[model samples]
Every structure is written in C-alpha cells, then in structure tokens.
Target: MSTQITTDRLVLRPVEASDAARIADLVNDPRVYRMVARIPANQTVAQTLAWIAGHTAGREENTKHPYAIVENGELVGVTSAHRDSTWLPFEIGYWLSPDRWGNGLMTEATEALVGWLKQRGERGFVSGYLDDNPASGRVLEKLAFMKADRIKVFCLGRGEMVGHVNMARID
Candidate 1:
C-alpha cells in the first residue's frame, strides 16, 4: 500500500485529484517534460486530472505508488515506485520543477523514499537516468545504486530514442 512520508523539507504523499492543476503546471514546463520519458509536453488540466485518476487507481490496484512532492504545502513535483514490464525489479522515478533544481530537494526526497522502502524490507530497487542528465546519475550514486547496464530507450516526451543508464541497489 502507498503511504505518506515526510522529510525535513518535503512531504511525499499519494497523488490526489486536487493536485491536477499544480501537477500540470510543473510537468507542462519543457524543462521538466524533457527529462521524463512518458509524460508529454503541454499537458492541460483535464489531461492531468485524468492521469491522476489513473495513478490513484494504479495505487489501489497495487500496480504503482505515485506521490506528489509537496513543499510548504504546495505541489512542486512527483516521485514514484512501480513495476517495469521490461525489467523485473521495482523502478523508482522522479521529476521536479525546473525552478527547484540545484537545491538538493530531489536528493533528499529520494533518500527518504529509499529509506522508507528499506524499512519495509525492500531491496534491489532499480532505476534509470537519461545519458544527458548526469545530475540524475549523481542522485542515484548518492543512494549507492550501482550502474548495471546502459541501453537505448525511446522517450515519449522527447519523441526520440535516448541512451539510458540502468542502476540498481541490491542492499
């Protein structure tokens, strides 16, 4: 089941319908969309609401855990842990508003989520970063995820294939 987690400066909670507007605003930014593989650019509120509904349903079905990243009670980004059909390990992914970059918030949020998973007896979580987004690689390194492999994957948002670095933390 999805649970709420709080860090020093952020709250990681399940996505809700009310979060549609803020989520749309953050993701509609080209900077944010460019880094995310599945999210399309220029998403409208209606589209975001539909996505949130699906996310909520996914959580209920035990298919995924998609969270809203709240800072000061405002949604600024999103993070999730879910199954990957192509890979057997649980996959963790996240994205933040461009304005919030360089602040270490993603690192902090990621660590908290990893800690939560560890406490629940979960290990060997998997994730990937685009070859161009070295910053994301650093975040995985901070979590002690070792590089497992590199592969080319199509980014739906970018509408092109990009190199990806697969990472895993077995401990």
Candidate 2:
C-alpha cells in the first residue's frame, strides 16, 4: 500500500482529483519543467485530472507511492517511490515548484519520505538526476545517496544529451 509521510512543515500524501489544477499549474512552470525530461507543452485541467487518476490507479495496482507535497494546505510539489526487486530495485523521484525553490525543503521532505519508506520495509533507494539539474545532484549528496554510476541521458524536451548520476542510499 502507498504510504503518507508528514514532516514539521510539510505533508506528503497521494495526489487527488482536487489537486489536478494545482498540479497542472506547477508542472507548467518553466523553471519546474526545465531540469526534467519530456513535459507536456500544453496540459489542460482535464488532462491533468485524467493523468492523476491513471497514476493513482497504477500506484494502487503496483504498490508504488506518489505523493503531493503540501504546505499550509497548498500544493507545492510531488514525489514518487517505486520498488522493483526484479530489475531496478528501489527508487524515489520528485519535482518541486519554482516558488519553493532554494528552501532546502526538498532535502528535508526527502529525508522524511526516505525514513517513512524505510519503516515500511524499503531500503537501498536508487535515483538519479539529469546533469543540468545540479541542484538535484546536490540534494542527492546532501541526503547521502552515494555515487554509483553515470550515463548520458536524453531529454526529449531540451532536445539534447545530458549526463546523469546514478546514486543509492543504503542506511
């Protein structure tokens, strides 16, 4: 089952239909989309709602967790965690709204999520970031995700090749 994690100043829970519009707005922000892979150029509220439904359905079926980050009852970001012992092992991912940038909240929020996931029998989280997003790389380091590998990654949106750092946390 998907889990909910809460911190002193943040709440991390499943994304709901009510969050679709907020999510759409956050995802469409140029700064938020810049460091990631392909993001839809034009996303309607209906499309975001449908996407949330699909994502939640898939999470329910697969036992993964996707969380909407909220502060003061306002959505500010999203995070996801998946376990695949067959191939990729455990992984976590997230994107923060530009408005909340530079707060180090991502690192704090991530540590809370990692501790929560570990309590639920999860460990050895593995994740990476496109090199262009050095902030993400810095977060990995701050969170003690050890360097494991590197590879050239493609960004469909940026239409260029970028490097990525493979990292893992096992404590």
Candidate 3:
C-alpha cells in the first residue's frame, strides 16, 4: 500500500519519529483523549515516541498502517487501520484536534483511506465510535458503513469500559 494519501485540504502520510512531540500534544488533550481508546489521557512525549516506534515496526511487518493527518503543513490528527489477526478485516480508527472539528476533514480523510484499501482489493472493514461521540458515528455513516453491533470496549485511555457502536462496510 502507498505510504501517503492527499485530499484537497489535507495530506495523510505515514507517521514518523519526528512526529512524536506533536502527536503527543494532540493526544494529551483531555477532550481528544476521552474519545480515543488506545491513547492514555495523560500521555507524555516519551510514551508517544514509543508508540510511534511500535507503529513503525508494525508498518515494516505489514501489521499496521497509521498516518499523520496534515493540514496547512501542520500535523492535526491521525488515522489508521490495524488488525488483531491477519485473517480478520482491518479496523479503521481516527481522531482530529478539537480546533479542526466541524469541518468534515475526518470524513474526507477516511473516505480516502477506504478508497485506497478498495483499490488494493480489500472488501471489508470494521470501525466503531465511542457511544458518547455521535460526531464520529456521523462520519462513518457518511462513508456508508452500517451499524453492525453495540458492545462494551475497554478504553485504556479512560481506564474504563465504554459503550461503542460498531460499524462495518463489506463489498
């Protein structure tokens, strides 16, 4: 798969080691951290660096594809696709800074990723939003993903179980 994708207003490129500090600043925001599952609420730059390193290794192994969302030459968010097992469909995930909310940038970024995956012959994907985040659900719906299930998912960032609305798109 290609390492970069661009939309009219944003560039999605592979995450790099140099992005750790910027990404840390974004994810460490309480507003952003509350909605994400994998990033800790009090995440530090060092932890963010480690996370980047792990994702880099995963990319080399073909196990994960994570991109930094850049707009106006600044990193503003992230999007990724990863799987628990090679046989399973990849799960899509994304988040954007609060300042960028309401601009439909995430919807565009996700559509680009989905299009890229389809071009590579991938036919199905799974994604979910925390129950509290209706905006995320709206984004998935805009991409034609159907709600498939509802379940409790443990959010490492929040250190608690939260309800998630699972959605899927299959060709």
Candidate 4:
C-alpha cells in the first residue's frame, strides 16, 4: 500500500525525520500534551527524532503506520496505528496543534487513516481518550467507534494515571 494519503483538505504521509522539530514543537505544547498519552512535556527535538525512527522501524516491520498530517503544506499533527501484539487490534492515536481544534481536521484525517487501514485488511481498531477530553470521544464516535471499556492509563505528559475510555471499531 502507498504510504501517502490525501483527503479533501489534508495530506497524510509517512512521518519523516525532517519533521522532528515541528513535531516536537506541536506535541510539547501544553495544550497538545495534556490530551495525548505518550509524549513528554517540553519534549526535545532529539527525542522527537528517536520517536520518528521508531515509526520508521515500524513501517519496515509492518506493525505500525504513523502519518504526518499536512494541511496547506504545513505539518499540523500526527496520527498512527500500532499494536503491542499480533492478536490485539491495532490502536489508533492522534494529537493536533491546539490552534487547529474544532475544525474537523482530526475527523477527516482519522477517517482517512482508518479507511486506508481497512483497504490494507485491518479489521479491528481500538482507540481511547482521557475522560476529560470529550472532543476526542466525539471524533471516535463520528468514525463509528463504540465505547468498549473504562480504564486508567498513564499519561506521561500529565505525570499520572488518568481515566481513559477505550473505544473499538470492528468490521
């Protein structure tokens, strides 16, 4: 399958090493970090590069697909699908620049990602959002992801475990 995907207003392409600086800047923003689970607050460019390398390895292994979300030729966010084990459904995750919120870009980007995965034979997907982030829930709901469970997961940025709502899309 092609690594590049495009929607009405965005281009979703494989995350590149060159995007490290921009990615770091976006994810390190307090607004973005608070909603995302894995990124550290005040993340450095080197750390971002390491993360990009992992995505590179994931691509080679066919175990993860991370995309750089581009709109109007600028990198605006990141989205990805990955699984810890073969039997588990691939989990979808994303975070965007706070300035871009409420614009439906996330839904558009995620829907395109899910559709791309479906075309590649991915049948089940899992995603979750912190309980405090209802906008994320709305995005998943728009994609037909049903609430599956409520659990606490560590939010590295938040520096503590937070209430999480897991959602799944099964085809």
User: In lDDT terms, which candidate is top?
Assistant: 4
Residues 93-112 of candidate 4 have per-residue lDDT tens digits of 99999999999999999999
Local accuracy of candidate 2 as per-residue lDDT tens digits, 19-91: 9888888888767666766455456789879867867765755546778988888889987776653244568
Please list all clashing residue pairs in model 2, or write none if there are none.
none
> How far does residue 101 in candidate 1 sit from its true spot (Å)?
0.6
Residue-wise lDDT of candidate 1 within 1-171, one digit each (tens)? 789999999999988888888888888888888887778878899998887777676676555778888899888888887774423456889999988899999999888887887786667688989999999999999989999999998887788999999999888
Clashing pairs in 1: none
Off by over 4 Å in 4: none
Candidates' TM-scores? Answer: 0.91, 0.87, 0.95, 0.97
Pick by TM-score: which candidate is best? Answer: 4
**How many clashes show up per model?**
0, 0, 0, 0
Q: Given candidate 4, what's the lDDT at residue 102?
A: 90
Local distance difference test, each candidate:
0.85, 0.78, 0.88, 0.92
- Displacement of residue 48 (Cα, Å) in model 4 is 0.5
Candidate 1 overall lDDT versus native: 0.85
**Compared to the true structure, candidate 2 yields what TM-score?**
0.87
Q: Per-residue lDDT of 1-171 in model 3, one digit per residue for the tens?
A: 447899999899998889988998998888898898777888888898888787776676556788999999999999988876667787999999999999999999989988877787778899999999999999999999999999998887889999999999997
- Candidate 2 residue 64 C-alpha distance from true site, Å: 2.1
Q: What's the lDDT for residue 7 in model 2? A: 90
